[model samples]
Target: SQQGEEDPQALSIQEGENATMNCSYKTSINNLQWYRQNSGRGLVHLILIRSNEREKHSGRLRVTLDTSKKSSSLLITASRAADTASYFCATPISNFGNEKLTFGTGTRLTIIP
Candidate 1:
């Protein structure tokens, strides 16, 4: 079962502007994680917000989670060209007796320089 999915398959923004992406999930989650990946590169962890938390910040990244709505949003302030990448949201799921992370489809963000 797919747990989480990001809205807006793609986004384009001007450098120094702000970018926002959203994610929605199907079930309860202990925490949600956001990740970034450059073209042909591995994914890098961005930020994680727990179910008990409403918002979190890291660097220029701000993440907000609304467990009641089963949704989350990521905001990037002062976007730069280097920030061009695909963003994904992930949630841990328990299948059978094991736990694994399920990632969303992703949102491709392009920063115009």
Candidate 2:
């Protein structure tokens, strides 16, 4: 039931600038993941960081997690016009015998040319 929520409902920036997004969750999670979705397209998994991990990076994407604060942040460096998309944070929910993943509302990022 709505585990995470992303900050900055929407973001706009120039092509060469950097973009940063944040997420906060209500309950404990085993892992947190980031995803990107282009307009009218499906999502692409970006990175996943375990609860024990503080930070992780893949290519131009960097993610940091703070379990104590129940928050996570995603940073995209050297943003390009093609980077315009919606980013979301996801967390797994385990209750009784039902287990599934819940996604945050998402942050819409627009990279201007």
Candidate 3:
């Protein structure tokens, strides 16, 4: 089964404000990955943090993982209007079948001008 669910199906904030989102999963996993997709563009890998790790950062983005609680969080600091995009959490699934990842529905983030 898939292992993660992001909170707040949608979010809106003025440009330059930080945006925060949460994710919760249901099963044990090898790793967690985050992605961003802009309209008409393909999903882009944002960052990847292994299960053995707790937190990771990339540029203005910060991510935290809690194995015990089966949850993760992503934070985009000083967000810009151009930062508007859909964010998704990917939990690595078992080798069962050929499935490599189970992606959550995702959170729609809108950065207001």
Model 1, residue 20: what's the lDDT? 97
Q: Judged by TM-score, which candidate is best?
A: 1
Model 3 residue runs over 4 Å out of place are 96-99
**Candidate 1: where is the Cα deviation over 4 Å?**
none
Candidate 2 — worst ten consecutive residues by lDDT sum? 92-101
Q: Given candidate 2, what's the lDDT at residue 103?
A: 95
> Model 3: per-residue lDDT, tens digit, 1-113?
57567888899999899999998888987788999999858999999989999999999999999999999999999999988999999997767677588888799999999
Estimate the TM-score of every prediction: 0.95, 0.95, 0.93
Lowest summed lDDT across 10 adjacent residues in model 3 is found at 92-101
Task: Tell me which of candidates 1 and 3 scores higher on TM-score.
Answer: 1
Q: What is the full ranking by lDDT, best candidate first? A: 1, 2, 3
Q: CA shift at 58, candidate 1, in angstroms?
A: 0.3
> Each model's C-alpha lDDT?
0.94, 0.94, 0.90
Ranking by TM-score: 1, 2, 3
Q: How accurate is candidate 3 locally (lDDT)?
A: 0.90
